[model samples]
Target: MTNIKSQSWCWIEKGEPEKLILKDQTVRQLEEQEVLIENSYIGLNPVDWKLISSGGANWKKNHIPGVDGAGIVIKTGNKMKHIQLGTRVCYHADLNKNGSFSTHTITNGKNIIYIPEKVSDSTAAAFPCPCLTAWQSFKKVPDVVNKKVLVSGAGGSVGYFLTQLLIDAGAQVYVTSSKKHHQKFLKMGVLNAVDYNLTDWKNVLLQSINHNSFDIIFDTVSGIHATGLMNMISYYGHMVAIQDRVKENTLPAFTTCISLHEIALGAFHTYASDAQIADLMIQGEKLLNDIGNSKFNLRDLNISDFEQLPRHLAELKNNNSEIKYVIKV
Candidate 1:
C-alpha cells in the first residue's frame, strides 16, 4: 500500500560477491497478488554465489541477489488475503526476480509461508532452500522405513536436513563427512559415519557396512563423486543427486535398474504448475511446524550483519564448513 526505499546489495557485474554494490532503491507498487516484506534476516546458500559468478541470465546491473529470507509482511496488494500486514513469514525468491538480499522485497503471496511462532527469524530464513530441497529429495524415495540409506556430504545444509528426515522416518542412515562431524552424526543415530577425508574412505564405508549396498543414496556432492557412488546402490534402489547427476551413458550397465533423481529446487518457481507450487508451500509449512515442535535438531547459525554478507559469501565459496550463515538485515 505504501512505497518504500530499500537498502540493498546489488549485483553490479559477474564474478564474486565483491562485484556487488550497496544502494538505496525505491520499491514500486506491488502487483495484485504480491506482498511486500521487510526482511529481518537473509540466509546464505552456495546458489547465491554461483548465480553471482554466472551473472544469471535474468540478472541486470544492480539486481538484488538472494533467495532465502524471513521477515514481516509490511504491505499486501489488493488480491492477497491469506497473507496480511504484520504477519511473520519466510520465502524462497524466484531465481529470475529481484531477491531477498535487500531490506525489502516483493514476491507473490503464494510463494511464502507463515513462520511458526517458535521458529526464529534466522531459522525460518535458513529453512527454505536446503530444507525444502531435502524434503523433495526425501519424498522421491517411496518409503524409507527400515531401509539402508547413505547421505554423502552429510555435513552440508541439505545433507543435514535429508539425513535427519531419513532417520526420523526410521531409515538406517549412513553418512560421509569430515571427521569433525563423525561423532555428531553418530550421536544423531547415524549407523555409521565415514570421514571422507581419509584416502580410502569409500572402502572404509563399504567395509563398515559389511559390503552391503544401500537402498537409497542421497548425494549432495556430484560429478565424479556421484558417479563413483553408483556401484554402491542395491538392485532397483534410488539415487537422489542435489547437484549434477551422473551422466546416463557413464552409468555402469549393471546399475541400469537403479533410479536416478535430480533436485533443482529453484526450478520449481519457473516450471511448476499451480498445484505443485501449492504443494511446495504446504511442504515448507510442514517443515516449519516440525521445527517448532522439536522434531529437528536445529544447528546454531553463524550470524553476521548485513554489510558482512559479501565477505561471508566469499568465504562460503572457498570453504566447505558446516556452519549456516544468516545475515541480520
Candidate 2:
C-alpha cells in the first residue's frame, strides 16, 4: 500500500541559502475540482529560490516552494471529469497553495494532464512551468506564421521550446545562444544561431539575415542590451519579455512604435478569470500532447534526488548551469 502521508521540503525562514527543512505535512481533503497526487518528480525553477529569498506576494510562511511536478493521481475530486484515479499526471501548482516539493500534493484537476506512457516522469515534470510560459508568450504575439522572429536567449528552457514551436509553425525563426551551442541550434531548424557573446554579435545577426528587422523579438535574457535589441525590431513590431521590465532608459525611440508585452505565468494564475484560466489550461494540455507525439524535444535536464533540492537550487541561483534541474520525489 502507498503512504498517504507526505514529506515536504519547506521554508521556515527567508534568505539566500534558504532555511529549508523536511516536515511531515498533512494532505488536505479534496475540493470538487482538486486531485491528490503522489509526486514522482519535481522540476526546479528560479521562482522557487526567489520565493525563499524575496518572499514574493505568493510566498507563504512555512510553505513548500516548487511549481512543476509529475505524479500519479491517487484521488480525484467528485466533479473532475477529465482525470481518473490511477492516471499518471504532470502539473503546475497554484500560487495560493503549497507547492510540489511534497511527496503528495494537490492541484486543480484543470491544471493537470495525463502523462503519456512513452514520456518519463522527469521529462513530464520538466514541461509545466517553462512550456506553459512559452505558450502564453507566443499566444500574445499576432500573426507569427511566416513572420520574422528572434529568440534572444534560445538556449534557456522557455526559449528552447518557444523556438521549436515557432519553427514548427513555419515562422522564420532566428536565435542567439553561446557560440558552443550555435551548431546545435542550427540542427534544431532555426534560420540562424548567432553567438550573443561576441562583441559584434548584434551586427553579425543583422549581416547574416540580410539586414531584415524582426517582426517579434522574444527577450528571455532581460537587461542584456535591451535598447539595442529593441532598435533592431521593425517599426510596429512586438517584443515579449519574460524577465526585464522595460524602463524609460531601455524603451525604444518614439518613432519606432514598438508593442511590448511582459509575460508572467504567475500573473495569469493569480489574475485571470475562470474562463480565461480554463482556456490557458486547455492550450497547455494541447502543447503537452503535441510534445508527446515526438514533434519536439525536452533537452538539457539535470536530475537530482529530492534530498538535494536546496543545494541544487543554490547552484541554480549562481546561473552557471546550462540545464534545468529536476528532483526525483
Candidate 3:
C-alpha cells in the first residue's frame, strides 16, 4: 500500500501564524493532472498575512500558510507535459485553495512553471506570486512611453518589482514607502520616494513637480487607510490596486476623473491562452534572470523549516521585509 502521508502547514480561523491551529499534517494523494512536488523553498506573499489578520474568510477552512514555492517534480500524472518528472521548478499555487507551506504538496500541473538554471531557488521562489502579479498588472497598463507612474506601497515584494519594471520601462517612477526605504528605493531606481508616515504626505507630494501628476497609480495596500495618492492622480488617470479597499473609508473628495480597479490576476490562470502564458513565462524568465544576476537589490537567500512550517509562518508574518522564504524539504 502507498504510504499516503506527507507534512504541511495550515492556518486557523483568524489566528496568528504562531498559534498555528494545524502543523505537520499528512497530504492527500495526487489526482489526475496533478503532481506531488517536494518543496525546496517558500516565497511569502501579503495575502498569507492578509487573510490571517483580515481578508478572505470565505475560504478560511483550508488556509494553508503559503502560496509560492520551488521544488522538484517527484510524481507527475500521465497527462502532464513539458514539465517532466524530477524537474526543478517554481510555482504559484492558487491561494483560493491550500498553499505551498509543506514538505510536499499535490498541485495541478498547469500552475507549475519550470525555473531557469541560472535562477537560484530563492529568486525562483520569490518570482511566483509578486513577480507574476507585477508582470500581469503591467501588461494590462496602456501606453508606457514617458508616462508618469506612481506606485504607492512600493516597498513590499510586488511593489518592489513593479517599481523596478516601471522604471525599466522608461516610466518616471514616484513611490511612497517608509522614509528609511527612500534612499534604498532611489538606489533601486525610483525617480522619487515619499514617506507615507509623514503627517503631511500630501503637501509634501504637492511640493514636488511630479506630485498630483500621475498617469497611472498602482497602489497595492488600500484595505484600511487612505493612501493619500488619490489627491495626486491627474484627471482621467487610472488607479489599479492588488488590494483595493472600499469599506466606508474613502479618499478625500477630488473632482479629478479616475478609474479604479482591483486586480487579482488569478483570473489569468483561467482566461489567458497558452501563447499568452508563454509570453508571461518568457517575461518572468528574463526578469528573474536579471534579478538573479544582481541587476537589482534581491539576494540569494534561504530559510528552512519543513515540519515546523507553522512556526515559520508565524515568524514570516511577523515582519515580512524580504520576498523569498524557502522551506528545505
Candidate 4:
C-alpha cells in the first residue's frame, strides 16, 4: 500500500468551529480490518459541533472532527480485500478515532456501507448519522401499523426520517414543527401537523387527536420539553428519545407501564459487540438501498466547499436551521 498525504480540518483546541485548523498529514497504514478512502463529501451534524465544544477525554491535539462521509475506497487491508478498490461507500466514523473531515480517512471495514448506483455522494455522506439514528429509534417499538404515533420536532433530519417511516408503515402520524413545514408534513401523509411556536401547542395537538393519547411518541427534542410530553402517551405505550431521555424522577408512576428508549448511534462503535456491529452494518445497507429506491425523500441540503465548513458549522450551532449541510472535498 502507498502512503497518501491528506488535507484535513483539525481540532486544534477545545472551542467552537473557529478553533479548527486546516493541515496536511500523511495517511497511515491500515490495520487488517481497515480500508482507506478518499473522501468526496463530508456531512455535518450537530454532534460534530457539540463534540468540539466539549472536547472528549479521548481527543488529542490536532484531531480530526467529523463523523459522516462518502468516498471511493483507494486501498483495503489484507482482511478487507473483498471490499474492492474504487467502490463508492459511506460511513459514520467512530467518535474516538480521527474522522472524515479529511481528504482521506481510514475506517473499519464492517462500519462502511456500499453506495447504490442511484444514490448521490452528497446524500450518502449525509445519510449515516441522522438516518441511522432514525432507524434505530424506529426499531425500538415494532408494531406501528394503524397505531397512533407522534413525532416531536418533525422538521429535523432524524424526525423527518422517523415520521416518513412511521407513516409508510401504516401509522397515523402526527407532528409538531414550524408552521413552514406543516404543509410538507401533511403531504407526506401526516394526520396533523401542529405549529410548535404556539403557547399551548401540546393542547392544540391534543384537540387534534380528540384528547386521545398516542400509542407511540418519538421525541427528537428532549430534556424537560420531552418530559412534559409524557402525559400524551397512552398507558403501556412506548417513547423513543433521540436527543436526551426523560429522567427517572420525571417518569409517571409504574402503573402507567410506559416503555422508554434512547438512541445513541455513535455509542455502537465503542460498546457494541462484533455481532451487533455487523447487524448495524446490515441495517445501514438496507436504509441506503431504501433511499436509492425512493422509499424515503431527501431533505433540502445546503452544499458548501470544504473551506466553508467552519463557518457552516458555526451557523448550524447558532441558528439550529432545518437545512442539512454537506461539504464537498
- Find the candidate with the highest lDDT and give its number: 4
TM-score of each: 0.97, 0.91, 0.84, 0.97
Clashes of each: 0, 0, 4, 0
- Models, CA RMSD each: 1.3, 2.4, 3.4, 1.2
Badly placed stretches (over 4 Å) of model 2 are 1-3, 223-228, 247-254
Per-residue lDDT for 66 in model 3?
A: 70
Segments in model 4 whose C-alpha atoms lie over 4 Å from true places: none
Q: Which stretches of candidate 3 lie over 4 Å from their true place?
A: 1-4, 21-27, 53-63, 210-212, 223-228, 245-255, 269-279, 296-304, 320-324
Better of 1 and 2 by lDDT: 1
Of candidate 2, the 10-residue stretch with the lowest lDDT total is: 243-252
Q: Give the per-residue lDDT digits (tens) of candidate 4, residues 77-119.
A: 8999998899999999999999999999999998998898989
lDDT of each: 0.89, 0.82, 0.70, 0.90
Q: Arrange candidates, best TM-score first.
A: 4, 1, 2, 3
> Of the pair 3 and 4, which is ahead by TM-score?
4
Candidate 3: 10-residue stretch with minimal lDDT:
245-254
Clashing pairs in 2: none
The TM-score, computed over Cα atoms with residue i paired to residue i, of candidate 3 is 0.84
